[model samples]
Every structure is written in structure tokens, then in C-alpha cells.
Target chain A: MAYTISADGLRKRYGDVQAVDGVSFDVEEGEFFGILGPNGAGKTTALEIIEGLREADEGTVSVLGLPPWPRNSKLLPRIGVQLQASSFFERLTAREQLQTFASLYGVPARRADAMLEAVGLTAKAGERVEKLSGGQAQRLSIACALVHDPELVFLDEPTAALDPQARRNLWDVLREINTEGRTIVLTTHYMDEAESLCDRVAIMDAGRILRMGPPATLVRGLDSPARISVPSGVLPLDDARALPGAGEAADDGVSLVIETRDPSAVVAAMAARNALTGVQIHGATLEDVFLELTGREYRA
Target chain B: MSTWQSFRSLGRAMFLGFVRDKGALFFTILFPMMFLVIFGGVFGHQSTSKVEVVEIGAAPLIDQAVARDADLRKTLKVTRYETRAAALKKVEKGDADAAVEQRGGTLDVHYSAADQVKAGTAQGLLGSIVESANQAKSGVAPTYRLAAQQVEDDSLKAIQFFTPSLLGWALASAGVFGASQTLVSWRTKGILRRLRLSPAPIATVFAARVVVSVGVALVQLALFLAVAQLPFFGLKLQGSWWMAVPAVVAGVLAFLGIGMLIGAWAKSQETAQSVTQLVVLPMAFLGGSFFPLDASPGWMRTLSYIFPLRYLNEAMLNVMGRGLGPMSALPQIGVLLGVAVVASLLAMRLFRWDSA
Candidate 1:
């Protein structure tokens, strides 16, 4: 498949800190591509480089077959963006803000109303932006981003501050837009959001793409198919590891955890011994893949 | 919509934004007008008192002669005083100009030195008394002319002088603050970074904002002019409104251009605000908006000439208050245009769309 965004050996530095270091990735057209990492994992920085916002120190990037900088004015109308910290002139009504954004792309007047309605902000269009609730303002921001009707849209942590219902509403709007043959590239820290919305995700850390694949593919690649947990005092660690298909076991204070390629076999053995009372088994998930790839170190 | 259409849209947005901002309007219009009315009323009363002088004192013998002289009685509204000290006290406080004391043939005249208007009136009275004494000795009298000079009255009140300037300050401040603050906030918000990936040119965006700001300022000036003509102020345009209009507009752009430079270069909105305020407030005050420059210190007058506001006020005051034409205002216009060009060029050079 052809890529809509392509970058090679991208590097970016902020004074003494390497914000992005030797990163590379490709996003295919019409694909929901997610850049995922812990905060400060350089996910945002790498995405910015690919978006043509920052110049890579020693890398090349092409978005829609054009260099991002020496900013290509001719290419601007083809894309939409939702900034991490979105804001507008406080006194402008939601309708006015949308209209202004539409004008920036030379879009028709009616497009603004359409975009606002799409974002479910048409009812409050007359109210000033400052007066809107956080969720409403966020919806207005999204409306402004879509007013131009670009083929590609970039959203950064768009649903971070939203309530669950609002987040779901945004997801539906995004899905509708995606169905219209537009590509979406998003950055997020929420694994669940990344898993559900992205067709493929690039896990990043220290300015590097540690792993890249579909959520299911990444999880299946883990050495352990399932993990068993139990109270730490319930079983001896050596004995738990000796179970059929159990590769290792560790005491986790309240549970004795075991990794197994076949959790059914391990459960059958536990049941044969009548030792299933305190055990729980779960398939490997995106979080396990994330923790394995980026490590569990706390980032500032 | 094309690029130009986008610009028009942004201009509309800015205009609507300001229209809804009551605080901004208050400072731009009502606050300045209030200052004008209060300052003008207080100062106008003081000015009128100096123009209408009261001269006191007379020898009873000369008073009889002066009261009998039809020519003298018609021109001078002379009042009798109980004591010479009382008359001199009034002159000293600028309430009266001249006080004459007569003992035999020697006449002593006292006048206030603080007010130039009072001093000039006192001098005229003294000259008349000297001439009248000489005429009396020669057994002849002098005649007075009753014709007034045809100087058309375009006397500007304090409000009339300050309204245009307050509007200029508002426009310039909004332009500088809007662009500079918006840029910084957008950067902090990661909007600029996202925009870089798109095909839009940052330079084009900046240019559009400047264009919008200048356009809106012109409209705001028209509003101020209309408000000046209301029944309360009774302002009249002495010169062609044409000359004053463009001059005021150019002045606003010039200051806005300078503000653009500060906005484009400053790292943060806090820095931009301080820089713009530091540059704007002094110029607004010393440029003769709130007060006339005639009696201001010579150094201050020389310094005021350097600020775009001063030249703008000069051109505006010339046309609006002095009835001068564009040709007469070319010098100030030339300076402001030069300022606009220089500021624009510097702003462009200093502007950075990214975090660089």
C-alpha cells in the first residue's frame, strides 16, 4: 500500500534535550494511523516532524508527496488539523469561528454551517466561544478543523478532556468522516482509544518507533498468550511455573502470576489439582504490548 | 473564497470580536470622551476667565473723567475697588489683569505675570492709558476701531482633539496585541506545528492579519468622527475631512506597523504587552492628545515630533482644528508614511511562524 506520509531518520532536538531522535514511520492513505506513547515519549514531536511543522535535524519527510516546509501554501487546503490546546477568539460565536476557518481555506459559506452541524454545535452556534462548556468548546474546535473539508485530518489528544459520552460522540463523527474516504492521523496516550480508532499504531519512546502493527497483531506477538493471577499466598511460585504450558510464575503480593501460551492447558492442570479457586486468566492486550515495548518507566 | 476572500472574512471576524467586547469599546470611546469632557470643562473655564479681564482702580478725579469718556466707557468694563491691594490680589490670581493706582500725576499699574493672555490684556490697557494721558495733555482724543478680525472659529474642545487619538491607540493596540498574543498562544497550543504540515504559508497568514487590522481601524475612525458631531460636543470639521481622514488612518497604520514589529519579535504575550505599552502610552500622552503642545516644554515638543502619534495629531489638528489642506500637511504625512514603511519591513524581517 502507498503511504500518505513518509519520513526517514527524523531527528529533532530542543536545546539540551533530544525531543525526537532517529524516528521513522509511514502512514498509508485512508488508514486511521495512531502514534502512541507515554507522555514525553516523543510521539508528539515525531508527529510534528511528519506533519511538516518542525524541521528534522537529519531526516527527510514527505506528506502528500510534498515537503512540509518552506510551508507549501498550495498544499494547505488539502488538510485539516486539531491542535492539542485548541482555542479561538473568546468573543466570537461558534458560527463566526467556523466561518473564519472556512474562509481560511476559501471554502463556501454554507460549508461552515454544515461542519458545525456535523459536530453537533449548530444549536449553540450563536453563543460566544468563551461561554461554551469545555465539551462544547471542544466540539466547536473540531467543527472549525473540519470546515475546510480536507482529505486528511490530524488530531492530537482530541478526546483527552472529554466525558465518555462526548468522547463517543466525537468517535462517531470521526468514523463518519473516515467513511467519506478521508485519512486520519492521530496521536494519543489512551491505549483503548488507539486500539479502537486506529487501523495501525506506531509505539514510540525516546523519539523512536519501538513497534508498529495492528493492535491484534501486536498483542498476538507477545511470548505469553495468557496470564494467570492469584493471591500471592495461594500458590508457591515454583509449583505454579511447573504447570502445563506455564513458562514462568512470579509472586505479585496478592497474586501468583503465570505466563502461558495455552491458558486452557494451564487451567486444566489447575482444575485437575483442584487449585483453580483463586486463579484468573486473561488474554494479552495492547497495554501488555505497550508496557513490553516502551517499558514501565515513569516519564516526566 | 480565494486568498483575498479569506482576508475579508478574517477582517469581519475581528470587527465582530471588537463590537462584542464592551470593555474594549469603553476604553476606546466612552473613556476617552469622559476624559475629554472633564478635562475640557475644567480647562475651558480657566481659559475663558483669562480672556475676559477685569481691571480695577481709579483716582476719583480721573474716574469721573473716564466714566464721562464715551469711547473709554464703551471698551473698558472697568470696576471700582475699595483698596489697591484688593485689585492687585485679583490680578495676581489671574482673576483680573490690570490695576491702576493714581496719586497726583504718577500712575502705578499692576498686572498678573503668570498668564500670557492676562499679561497681554494688561499691556494693551497700559498702552491705552499712556496714549490717553498724552492726548489729554495735548487737548485731543484717540478713536477706537470696532471691526473684528474674520478668523473662522474652529476651536477644538479637548474631546475633539483626543477622540481620534484614543481611536488610533485602540486600533494599534488591538493589532499588535492580537497578532502577537495569538501567535504565542497558537504556538503554545501546537497549532503552528500542525499548520506547518499543511500547504499554508505562515507569511501569508501574518500578512492577512495586518491587512485586516488596518482595514478595521479605518472603520473605527469613521465612527469616532460621527460621534464627535453629536449635539453634546458640536465638533465641526474645519479642513477637508479628506485630509484628516487619510492622515489619521496612516497614523494608525504606522503605530500598528510598529506594534507588528514588537508582536512578531516578542517571545511571549506578556513581553509584547509590556513592550507595546511602553511604546504607546508615552507617545499618546506626550504627543498632545490630552493636552495642547503650545506651552509644553521645548524638549518634550522636540521628542513628540519623533512619535507617529504627534505627526498624526498635528495633521489631524491642522485639518480638523486649523482648517488646513493636504498640501499643508504633507510634512507630517511624509513622516508617518516613512514610519509605516520602515516598521512594516522590520516586522516582516523579524517575524517567525514557528518556535524558532
Candidate 2:
């Protein structure tokens, strides 16, 4: 398969701090790839290096088979970038802002209106960007990026600081863009957003990637125990512990919980005892994998 | 993406932004036009007032001339003093505009320098009186005579000078302030990074900005000329006045370069604003925008040479105010273009895409 982006041993430093340390990754065509990390994890730095906004201290990056550094013009027309901070031309209306960007890429003016409609900002198209709410402004910025219809798109925390509804709405927009078979590389701190949207994710921290894989594959590799729980009083703590295949059991006020390698055996034992009322089975997720790998709570 | 398309789009957007900004409109166009109105009203149709002269020790020549010529009598209000020292002291104390005494064939005239206009009138009146007296004594027509005439139009008023000088001031402020503020704000706001990521060439982006700024400056020049030409102000455009167009373009480019240098160096809007003010205000005062440089002290006139606005004002005044030929503006244009190239190169060295 032809890779859309290939980065090798990327390293960047800012004074005393190593912003990106020996990071490497490859993205295939039409892939929705993500770099997931907390606020200080150097995800933005790594993304910037790949986007040609900054030079790396050490490493090589190729997008669409072309080097990005020193601003390769050929690659610019083929890729879209949405920065963490959304900035527009002064006092321009939403449509005008998109149209200006479109003109820069030699795209027709009609694409601006079409892109605005696609982003569901047609109603507010005539309003100045400053007047738009955060979500609307974010949408306008994304539309500007996509106005030229580049084959590859880079979004740096496009959904950060947004309300839940807005975030979900933006997720839909992003999914539709990806559905059009364009490769997308995203940097985000939201674990659920990464897990749901990215085909593969690189979990980073302290300027290093801890793991890189499909979310489900990474979670399954963890081999962590599942927790099965029922409403308190449904099963006595002692009986839960004595159940076959249950590694440990406890009653924590609201629920009687059992940790077991085989969730099916635990659930079967609970059902046999007529103690399956309100049973909830918790499986290993990407969050647990992050915790297990980092040996700390996932703050983001 | 063609460079022309990028230039057109960016230029159109910037021009729209400028026109839509009420504060910029007021400062760049209306403010200088207001100065023309105020200065024109004060000095446009001035009539010379009488000068007070102190006669020290028997100036028979002046006494006879004042008695004979009604014009001299109306212009000079003469008073007698006992001693030359007392008359000189009176002039020094500003109580009298001049002190005059006839010493043999030479008439001694001393005028206070505190008010140049009044002193000039007094000196001219007394000198003419002495010359006529010499002719009467000789009792023969003089062989040679000195002819004096103004190089500019006969109807030239203060409006002519104020229009071009004030217009130069407006263009300087607008170019510097506009370029610096735009650059710093764009850096701080991350718009510079956004533009960098676009397919448009960086050169194209700046070229568009330059084009827009020059276009706005031309509009300012036109508005200033139209307003000053109104019969109330009576500004007459003279020989090669059209040459002010090229002068304005060069001047704007020079100011824009300085502004960009400031913008590239300053990390914030406040810093850029204060620096532009520091550079512009002093330059305006020293550049003959507020007053004629000829009336300034020698040191100040020399100091004004360092400012690009001085060259701009001089060039425009040569063509528009003094009615000089187009060739008169060439040297100033060359200096302004040199400044533009040098400052722009330095600005390029300091330019940053992000405030960080």
C-alpha cells in the first residue's frame, strides 16, 4: 500500500526541553490517523513538524512523497492544515474568510459557499468571524482548510474546549470528510474522540509515543481483567468471591463487583444464583491501556 | 495558484478592511484634511500689519520719506528716542519691532528676531527709504535695478503648502501605523502562520499589502487636493503637480518599510503602537509638516534630513506648492526609494511567522 505520510525518527527541542523525541510513524492513504496525548505531550510539536510549519532538530518527514520543510509549494496545494488557534482575516465575514483562502489556492468562489453549507454554517455565513460563537468559528476555520479540497488534511485539536454537542457535531463533519477517501491526521487529547474517529492512534507522553495501534487491538493486547458488577444485595460478597473464575470480589455500597479473567463465567455464575439484576460488565478500553502503559491516571 | 490571483484576493480583502474601519478612515483621510482647513483659515489670506519702529538720534532720511510716502507712513509707526542704546533696548525688550538711525550715508537699522514676519517688514521698509534717499541725493536715474519675483503662482496661499505637507504627514502615519499594526496583530493572532500554510507565495502576500497601502495613499492625495482646491481654501495646483503621485508612492513605500521593521521587531501591538508614535511625531514636526523648514534654526533643519518624511514633504512641495518642474522631485524620490529598499531588507531579516 502506498503510504500518504512517512515520518522517521522526528526530534525537536526548545531550549532545555525536548518537544519531540525520536518519534516515528507512517500513515496510509485514506487513513484517519491520530496522535493522542495530554496538553504537554508534544503532540502539537510533532504535528507541526510534519505540517512544515517548523523544522525538526533531527528527523525526516515526507507527505505525499514530498519533503515539507522549507515550505515545498507542491505539497502545500495537496494538504490542508487547521491550526490549534483559529485565526481569520480581520473583520471578514465567514463566507469572505473562506473565499479568501479559496482564492489563495485558485479555487473558485462558489466553493466557499459550498464548503460553508457543508459545515452547516450557511445561516451565519454573512456574520463576521469575530461574532461567531467558538463552535461556529471553529467550523469556519475547518471549512477554510478544506475549501481547496486537498488530498491530505491535518487538524490540531479541532474539537478542544468545545461543548459536548458541538464536539459530536464536529465529529460528524470530520467523519464525512474522511468518508470522501482523504487521509486525515489529527492531534487531540480527548481519548474517546481518538478511539471513535482514528483508524489507528499513537498514544504519546513526555515527547514520546507509548504505543501505536488500532484502539481495539491495543486494548486487547493489555490482557487486563474485566469487572462484572451487580446491584448491592443481589449477591453476598462472600458468594461472589467463591464463584468459579472470579479472581476477586467486593461489595462497594452500590454494587457487588467481581474481577475475573473470564467475564462469561462470572456472568453465568451470577445468573445461576439469580443475582444478575442490574449486572454491568466492564471490558478493557483504550483508557485502561493508557493507564497500564503510563503507570498513572489518564488526566486528559 | 497564480501569483496574480493571490495578490488580487489579498489586496481586495485588505482594501475592504481599511475602508470599513472608521478609525483608520478618520485618521488617514479626515484628520489631515482637518489640518488643511485649520492652517488655511489662519494663514491663507493674511495681510501684513504695521511695524513699530523706534527712531534713535536723528534719522532725517526716514523722517522725510515717512512724511512724503503715505504707504511708508501707514506701514511704519515711528517713535523718537533720546539715545541709540535706549532705542536698541526697546527693540530687545519687544516694546518696539525695530530701531533705526541715520549714520552718514548709511542708515543703521536694527530689528528684533523674535518675530520674523514683523522684523522682515520693518527692515524692508527702512532699506527702501534709504535707497530712495540716495537716488534723490545723486539726482540721476540708477544704472541697474534688482528685480524680485516669486517663483510660484501669484495667487499662492498657505493652503498650497499645507495641502501637500499635511498629505505627506497623513500618508506617513497611515503607512507606518497600518503596516506595523497589521503585521504584529497577524503574528500574535496566528494569521501569519495560516498564510504561510497556504499555497500563496509569501512574496505575493506582502506585495498585495504594499499595493493596497499605496492605493489608499493615492486616494488620500486626491481627497486632499480636491478639498484644498475648494474656493474657500484656494489651493492652486501648479507645474508638474501630477509628479506628487510618484512622490506619494515612493513615500508610502518608505514609511511602510519602516512600519514593517517595527512590526517585525515588536512582539505585541502596544509596543508597535508606541514605537510608531515615537518615530512619526518627531519626524512630522522636523519634516516641515507643521511649519516651513526655512524658518527653523539651522540645527533643526539639518536634523530633519534624517527623516524620510522630510524628503517626501520636500518633493511634494517642490511640485505642488513651489510649482517646480518634475525634475525637482527626482532626488527626493531617489532617497525615498533607497530608504524603502534598505528598510524592507531589514524588515525581512526580522520577520517572524509567530509571536513565539
Candidate 3:
């Protein structure tokens, strides 16, 4: 296992609050790793520690085979970061902003325009950053982070304040960035984005990673494998329990839900009787796994 | 990229950003001009009124002729005196505005040193009347002569003495307030934090800001000197005008260091604005930007020395207004350079990329 970033026993304290407490993880080369947590879960703090934006009270962290602490001069040029709610120079167009950042690494100006096109901001290259919509600005922010063409990129809630469509649009951009073989470590609380984008995730809460694995593996580890629902009017609640592989039957107003390990068979039976008008079989999700593992909701 | 190359790129970007900002541009170019128009219109030109003269002999003949004319009589009030000593006494005691004695065809004028401009005006008016009377008597070109004296230093005019200080005030506002607000906003907006994430040296970033401020201050000085050059003010650069260049640069950098300190201390925009106003207004007052601090209380004069604006103002006045050479301006320039060095070092020590 070749890892691009590895950390152990990281701890950071802000006044009396323990921001990143005894956390550790390793992200392999070219892997899209994610830290999934609600706000204030210390994910940002942990990510900042790795990015060298902050110091850990007690920890040993390495990035690209070198320590990231004390701000390694060699390490900095090899990584990119898009901080949460980032801001740019006032009235500076998106292209110029990227050029300025590129200059920091000695990258050519042409890369700035190219990076703009990469982020789907080609038409907006001349528009001032303040005029950009939230999604566009976020995309530009990511473009700035990647302008130097670093191998590892960190995005902290890249789609935090966007509409669902905009969020989806930004998700495609992130996936495209990863497709270019760059290792990306992003922090997000949205489970669907995590499941779709991240190769592996560390579900965090209260400064700790409770579970670390692929999304489906973690979800499948939940006690209930699937939940099947059909309208109660199709067949009264008591009769649905008699269906095969139905673990527990419950009526949830207008529908009867049956927990089942074999939803395919359950779904087929409902369809045979012309009772499949609204039959819905949902596999366990990361949210369910999070709730089952942490004994708390995924949001604050 | 090399550090210098990075610095140039960043500096160019910063300069563009500052100039393109309409509010910043307006304040940089227009705010100081406002003070100039207001103050210059009021104090640029001067004129004098009627004078009461004690004539020793009363035989200039033109005095009698002038007495016959309503306008001339209204302007010069001449009275006869028995003796020169008595007239001189009256003038000394401030009873008479001036005493005139015509001897060997050259009028010896004794004006009470109450006000130099008033005394000078009286002498010129009396001499002109004497010449007119003589010309009427001889049908020849009249002579211009009068012995004028004042026991005090009144060598400065209203316009020349205050304009340089006003220029310094403008630079201070543009450099100090401007830089402080910029640093605060960047920190509050996460711009500084984002820059920290990059490999760019912190000094390189701040160097760009410092360079831009110095450039703005220089432009401000040029604009003021041009305005000061108009015939209305009739200003002469008493010393090498080039001395003001170093003075303006050093002064702006010194105040920029102060601005950095303010930015370091102020955690938010409101706090920065309040602190900037508090520092700038009082410094302008005590540093003699508006009026001479010599008339201010003694302690205030002593306390004003603690602020860099005072040295900057005095330095500008020394070079451009006082027209003193670079060596003569050394004391003020030394203070400014010292401030630039020490304050900048302290500010660098205290400056932070984030409130956290």
C-alpha cells in the first residue's frame, strides 16, 4: 500500500475545544478520499493540519513521503487546497485570479486560461470574481487550487452553499479532476456526494473517525440490509409479513414497509399480484449506517 | 518562480486591484484635492486696509493734495505731529499706526510692529502719496523710498506654509488608512488565509502591498505639487524639490508600518475603520497638518512628536515649503526612516494571516 498522505495521533486544541483529537488516517496515491462529517466535527481542522495551514498539538504527519509540519518548502508546491468559503481579490476576473495564483508556483499564464476552461468557466474568464454565482466562484476557487498542477488536492466543502443542480455540476468537476489521476481529499457531510465521488471515506463525528471503508461496504454492514415498502391498500399490513424473506413488517401510513434481506424476491411477489403500484425497495444508505454506528443523526 | 519574479507579478496585480477600485481611487486622488480647494480658496491671496499715519513735518504737499481727494483721504489717515520724538513715542505705544518724517527727500517711516503686513501696507501707501505730491510739484518721475522695519519673524505666508503639511496629511490618509483597511479586509475575507495556503512567502505578499502604497503616495505628491504650482498660491520649492520625494516615500512607508500594526490589532472591518479614523484625525490635528502646532499647548507639541505624521509633515515643509536642502531636512528624514524601520519590524512581528 503506497500512501500519498499518512497521519497518526493528530491532536489540536483551540482554547478549551479539542478540534482534532487523536485522529489518524492514510490516503493512497490517486485515491479520492473523503472525510464525511457534520459541521464542527473537526474534519476541517484535521484536513488543515495535513495541509500545513495549522499545527497539530501532538502528531506525526507525512505528505508525499515528507513531513508537512513546519511547512515543508518542497511539499507545498506539490499540493493544492481550496479552503471553505474562500475569497479572491476584489474586481479581479477569474482568469486573472488564477494567473496570480499560478505565478506563485511559477506556472505559466496560459495554464490559467486552460484551468478556467477546465473548471467550465471559459465563458466567465473575463467576469470579476465577485460577479460569479456561488457555484461558479466555487469552481473558480477549485481552479485556482489546481492551477499549479499539483498531484494532491484538498477541497473543503467545495459545494457547501450551492443549489442541488449546482452541487451536482460541481461534483462532476471534482470527479473529472480525479479522473486525471490526481489524488483528492475532500471534506463533506453530503452522503450521496461521498458515495458517488469518494473511493473511500472516513465517517467522522466529534473529532473521531467512527468508520473507514467504501460507502457500500459500510452501509452493508448495517443491521438491516434493505427496507421494502408498498401501499397498505394493496394488501393489508398483516398479510405483507407473510411474504418470504420479510424480517419485520410495519405500517407507515399509506404504505406498509417490510425489512427484508432479499428485496428482489419481495419486489417480484408484489409485482405478480398487481400490487406493485408504488413498491419501493431501498438498500441501507450511509446515513443509516452512520445512525446505527454513532447512535446520532448525521447532521448537527 | 524566483522570489523576485513572484514579487513582481503579485505587485502588479495588487497595483491593478487598488487602482481599479472606484472608492479607493476616488479617495486617493479626490479627497486631498477637496482639502486643497477649501483651504486654498480661503487663504491663498491677501489684501490690507486703511492706515493712520502720524506725519512729522506735514509738508510733503502730496499729503495735502491727497487730503483734498475723497478716495485718497479715505485710504490714508495722516495727522500732524509737533516733534519726531513724540510721534515715535506714539507709534511705539501703539497709539499711532506709523510715524513719517521726510528727510533729504527720503521719507523715514516708523511703523508700530503690531502686524507686519499691516505695517508694510501702510509704508507702501504713504510712499505712493509722497511720490504723487512730489510729481505734482516738479512735473518729474516720483521717487519710491521708505525705511520699513519689523522686530519679528513674519517671513511665511498662509498658502506656502500649510500646503506641504496638507500634502503629508493626504499621504498619511492614503497610505496608513488605506493599507490598514486592506489588510483587515483581506484577513476577514480569508484572502490572507488563502495566500498562506500557497507557497508564496509572506514577505513577498506584503512587499507587493507596500510597493503599491508607496506608488500611490508618490502620485499623490505629484498631484499636490502641481496644484501648489498654480499662480494662485505662487509656491517655490525652497529646497531641492526632489527632497520631498524621499520624504513622501519614507513618510508613507513609516505610516504603512503603523497601518500594519493597526491591521494586526483590529480583528474586524468596523474595528479597523474606527481605529484608523481615531489615529488619522488626531495625528492630523497634533502634527500641524491644519494649523501650526506652535500655537497648540506645549504638551501637545511634545506629544505630537511621538507620531510619525509630525516628522513627515515637518519634513515635507522643510523641503518644499521651507525650501531647505536635503542635509537640512535630515533630522525629519531621520525620524521618518527610524519610524519606517522600527514600526515595520514590529508590524512584521505582529502581523497574522488569520484571526485564529
Candidate 4:
């Protein structure tokens, strides 16, 4: 199978910080590949390296079988990129912005109208970019990126600052692009978004891929404990951790919650210890699996 | 896509961008026109008011004595102030030529440093008036002699005096280097980075910006010239259009290089603007935008020589004012070319791909 993106031992550093220290991955053609990580997990740094925006200090990266960098490469026009927080000329209309990008790619300007429509920004085609809502601007950005109908696309947090509805709308657009036999590589921190959008996901941390697989497979592999909630002040933190089958117990403002794989066993033991009264079981989510694998703390 | 095609596309975008930017139009074009109208209206064609001497006391004969001296009457419009103190106040304010007081047998003259030449002229006139009074009232004639010098040149015009500097400053004001700033900002916004991944070469984007900007700058130049040629001002273009055409093109390139250097060297738009001011402000002022300095000190003149605006101004002045040929402007042209080459090289060197 042909891979849309391939990298081996990619390494990049700025000053003393090893931003993308020796990362390697292959994204299959037409696959929606997602890079999921916490903030500063080197997701953006790694994406930038593959997109040809930054040079890798060591290792090789090939996008659609061509090196991306300052040197001339034929693969550039065949790829579309939606960068996080990218802006258009404030004075330019959405259609004009799209057309400009199309022209830069040496594509016909007629496609700009269609791209705008695809992104649901056709009604605001003549409106200046500065006047567009946050969602509208994002849609416009996406339209500009896709004006040339490229086969490979890179969207770095394409829906980062959008409202839920806008984000959903953008996701639908991305799906449509993917459905048309084009491959996509996106980086996002929203676990649900990554699960919903990506065919395969890579969980990154500290400039390295901690895990990579299909979302379902990755989630299933995690032996994360199901959470149990109890009334506030019901159990002390130490007593809960000491219980059999309990992994960790955390206190919510009004409730005590515990993580454990064998929820039933833990509940019975808690009942014997008089620690299960008023406790409730909740289903596991991607956040739980993420916290279990990456630790339940924020990293800058 | 070929490089030409990419540049063409970028050029179209830049032109559209410029057209849509109303604020830029207002500041670059309209604001400068307003300034020119206000300052030119106030100062242009106004004669110098150098000196004022108030003759006081026992001058009924002195009044008649002033009437006898045609040279004094022609040169000085002696106004009668309430007192010598009032005249002295006028001199202190740089409003008077001199104040003359005759108390007892002593004569006192008060004048300002600003009006030194006028003061001397006033003193000479006063002495002649006194002599004439002595001849008329006391029958004692005093001997004196005077010389006169005359010059005639029908070349000077108000527009020519203002245009060169105004053109340079206006072109430099919000243009030239502004393109680089815009590009850098686009990069910061991630738009340029996105563009970088596209088929278009980054060099094409730069070329397009220059093309559109140069075109707009030419339009502004034409507008300033048109405004200067209204019936009242009647600005004459004395030099061959050929002489000025190349210089204007050269001036654009030179300043564009300076602007590019600022844009490339500075990390942010704000820093670029500040740097642009550092180069533009002094060149506009000291290089002779607001006022021409024919009589300013040598050091000041020397400093002006180092500025591209100064050479541009001199070259333009020679062509527009003296009807000189292109060869007459070779030194200025050479300096402008040198500035352009050096600035372009520096800009290329300092140009950064990322905001960091």
C-alpha cells in the first residue's frame, strides 16, 4: 500500500529544546491520520517538519514521495495545509482569498467559488475577511487551503478555536475531502474529535509517539479503571487507595471518585468496608484512557 | 506552475489588497495632501518680516525726515508703536525690526538676534533719517553714501520647492518597506507558511508586492504633480521628463530596498515601522522636506549629502528648477543607485522565513 506520508527517525531542535526528537510514522493513502497530544507535546513541531515548513535537524521525511523544504519540490502543489490560527488579508473577500491561493498554486480561479461553497462560506464570499466570524474565518482558511483540490492535506488544529457547530461543520468538510480518495493528516488535542475524525491516531508526548493505532484498538488496549463516584466526605483519600481493585481515588468538589478496572469487586469490598454507600459507576471515555496512559496532569 | 504565473497571481492579489485597504489610501494619499495644503498655504509666497524700528519723541521733523529717504521708505514699513517699550516687545517676539529711542541726547536701538540683518538695515535707515532731520531742522547736513545690489531669476516656483521632499517622504511614509511588513505579518499569521507549502515560489510573492506598490506609488506621484499645477500655483516642469523618469524609478527602488531591509531585519511590524521612521524621519526633515536650506551650516549640508532623499531632491531640483540635463544629476543618480544596491543586498541577507 502506498503511504501518503512517510518519515523515519525525524529529529528537529531549536536551541537546547529537542522539539521533535526522533519520531517516525507512516500514514496510508486516503487515510485520516490524527496526531493527538497535550499542549506542547511536539505535535505541531512534528507536523511542521512533515509539511516542509521547517527543516528536520536529522532523519528524512517524504510527503507524497517528495522532500518538503526551501528547495524546489513538485509535491507542494499537490498538498493543502490548514495551519492553526492562520489569517487572510483583512481587506480581502473570502472568494478573493481563495482565488489568490488558487492562483498561487497555478490552478484556475473558478474553483474558489466551489471551495467557498464546500466550506459553507459561499454566502459571505464578498465580505472582507476581517468581518467574518471566527468560524467563518476558519472555514475560509480551509477553503483557501483546498482550492487546488490537492490529494494530500495537512490540517493542524483546523478546528481549534471554533464553536462546536462550526467544528462539526469543518469535520464534515474534512470527511468529504477524505471520502473523495484524498489522504489527510491532522493534529488535534480534543480526544473525541480525534476518535471521530481519524482512521488511525498517534498519541504523542514529549516529542515522541507514546502510542499509535486505530482509536478503538488504542482505547481497548488501555486497562484504565472505570470511575466510581461517592458523596463528598464519604471516604478519605488514603482509605480509598488501600481498597482492593482500586487504582486511584480523586475528589470532585461534591463527590469522591475512584478509578478501578473491576468496578463490581471494588464496590463489594467498599460495601464491606462501609465505603460503597451512595457510590455510582460511570462509563470510561477517551479522556480516562488518555489520563491512564499519559498521567493525569497537564504538561506545558 | 511557472514562476511567472505565480508572480502574476500574487500581483493580482496584492493589487486587490491595496484597493480594498481604505485606511492605507487615506493615510498615504489624502493625509499628505492635507498637510501640503495647510503648510503651503501658511508659508508659501509669504515675504520675510525681518525688522521693525519705532522712532519716538520730537520726531515731527523726523517723520518728514523719513519721507525724504526713498531707500528707507521702500525697504522698511515703519509702524508707529505706542512707546519704545512696545516696540522693544515686538522685537523680542521676533516680530519687529528694531526699536529706536531718543531720550535726552542718547539714542538707543533694540533688536532681536533673529533679525540681525534687518536690524543693521534699520540702524542705517535710522541714522539717515536723523541726518536728514538734522539737515532740515538744524541746517546741518551729514554726508553719507550707500550701495545697492540687484538679482533677477525667473526660475523658482513654490511647487518645485516642495515637491521633491514631499514626494520622497510621501513615498516613504506608508509604502516602500510596508510590503515587507505585510509579508512578515502574513508569515506570523501563518498565511505565508501555508503559502510556502503551495506550488508558488516565495520569490513570486515578493515580486508581486513590489509591482503593485510601485504602480500605486506612481499614481501618488502623478496626483501630487497635478495638485501642484493648479492655476494659482502654476508649477512648471522645467526639466526633460526623461531626466526625472529614471530618477523617480531609481528613487522608488532605493527606498523600496530600504523598506525591504527594515521589513526583513525587524521581527515585527511595529519594529519595522520604528526602523522605517529612523531612516525616513531625518531624511524628510534634514534632507529638506518642509523647508529648503540654502543658508544652513556646512555640517548640516554635509549630513544632507549622505541621505538619498537629499540627492533625489537635488537631482529633481536641478531638473525642475534649473532645466538641467540628466548628466547634471549623475552624482545624485549614482548615490541613489548605490543606496538601492546596498539596501537590496542587506534586505536579502536579513530576510527571515519565520517570525522567530
In order of appearance, the predictions have TM-scores of: 0.83, 0.84, 0.86, 0.79
Q: Output the number of the TM-score-best candidate.
A: 3
**Highest DockQ: which candidate?**
2
| Order of models, best TM-score first | 3, 2, 1, 4
lDDT of 1 by residue, B1-356 (tens): 36676666756766687668787667655665566556545554342233233334555544654666875554455566777677877778766666777767766667666877667866675566666666778875557634655454634555555555555555555555555655665555455554454344455565665666666566667776777666565567675657876786677668767876887788877887788778878877888776777768999999888778788778777777666666766788789889988988998898666654
- Once fitted onto the true fold, the runs of candidate 4 whose alpha carbons sit more than 4 angstroms away are A227-282, B47-153
Question: What TM-score would chain A of each candidate receive against the reference chain A?
Answer: 0.85, 0.96, 0.94, 0.83
The DockQ of predicted model 4 stands at: 0.48
- Candidate 3 regions exceeding 4 Å error are A250-253, A297-300, B47-155
Can you tell me which runs of candidate 1 are displaced by over 4 Å?
Answer: A13-21, A57-59, A163-165, A229-259, A271-280, B50-123, B126-208, B219-236
Local accuracy of candidate 1 as per-residue lDDT tens digits, A72-175? 67656777878777657548888888877777677777787888888888889889888887778777887877788777788888888888888888888878
Ranking of candidates on DockQ, top first: 2, 3, 1, 4
Record all residue pairs in model 2 with backbone atoms less than 3 Å apart, i.e. clashing: none
Q: What is the TM-score of chain B in candidate 2?
A: 0.76
* Model with the higher DockQ, candidate 1 or 4: 1
lDDT of 3 by residue, A1-300 (tens): 658999999999998999888998999999999999878889999998999888899989999988887877788899999988767887788988998888988888889989988989999999988899999999999999999999999999998979999999999999999999999999997888899999999988778888999998888787676887777787777768887777789996877888888888877777776778777878888878777766674353
Over the full model, what C-alpha lDDT does candidate 1 score relative to the true structure?
0.72
Q: Name the DockQ score for candidate 1.
A: 0.55
lDDT by residue for model 2 over B192-311, one digit each (tens)?
A: 999999989999889999999999999999888898899888888987999999999999999999999999999999999999999999999999899989889999999999999999
Query: What does the lDDT read for residue A103 in candidate 2?
Result: 94
- The root-mean-square deviation over C-alpha atoms between each candidate and the true structure, in angstroms, is 4.6, 5.7, 6.2, 7.3
Q: Model 4, range B1-356, lDDT digits (tens) per residue?
A: 87787788778767777777777788778877776676556655554343355665444444565576665564666667766677777888867777766665456777778867777888887776666556666765656655654321344655667765677677766565566567567767766666677777777777777777778778877887788767555567774634765676677778888888777777777887677778888888888776786757778888888778887777776776556776877788788889989988998998766775
